[model samples]
Target: MPSIAYILSAIGIAAGITFILRLIPFGIKSILKDNKLIADLAAWIPMGAILILGVYVMAEIDYSSTTTALPYLIAAVVTVLVHSWRKNIALSLLIGTATCVVLANWVF
Candidate 1:
């Protein structure tokens, strides 16, 4: 059997490593804040992710079936319109998601 000191030491080591790993990102964030590349990445990454996701979603739609594609098309249109009009990301996303859900469940 392992001694109590050995187990305690193992636990302490694990906890210290966990804490340090979690802290490293925060420490680096300040250093990266002024970096032009990181700043550009921060601005573009979400847009890239959204674009990728939109492409993936569109690819899943059945082009032959109007019924299958209609809800997604409508929801995407509403999302863009809402975002353009209100300039609120959360509201646009909520409205878009709700539109998709309602149309998919009831209309489509």
Candidate 2:
């Protein structure tokens, strides 16, 4: 029942909104880059997130069963060691996840 022009107008409105939304971050990025407090917060936030995630994961482990917790402990250790030694996040995460998966499936 809708006219062709109505459908085209709706599509054009959606496309325009999407384009503007995509441009907003780039528009604000230059302003944020010059802000020292924002820069510090941005730098600290990822480390904070990692710490929170680590605490959450550790808290979920069952201490009563060594087998249940061993893989996670091992993986965490491996991840920390790799990251410390190589300073490569992607490599550390990949190795850590693989270690956990292998240990859980085969050793644990």
Best by lDDT: 2
**Model 1: per-residue lDDT, tens digit, 10-100?**
9999999999999999999988888999989998998798889888998899879888889999999999999999998789989998999
Model 1 ranges off by over 4 Å:
1-7
Q: Candidate 2 clash total?
A: 0
Candidate 2 wrongly placed segments (more than 4 Å): none
Candidate 1: RMSD to truth: 1.9
- Estimate, for each residue in 1-108, the C-alpha lDDT of model 2 and write its tens digit: 999999999999999999999999999998888899998999899889888988999899897999989999999999999999999878988999899999989998
Query: For model 1, what is the alpha-carbon lDDT of residue 107?
Result: 97
Q: Highest TM-score among the candidates is held by which one?
A: 2
Candidate 2 residue-wise lDDT at 62: 92
- How far out, in Å, is residue 57 in model 2? 1.2
Q: Candidate 2, which ten residues in sequence have the lowest lDDT sum? A: 46-55
Predictions: Cα RMSD each: 1.9, 1.5
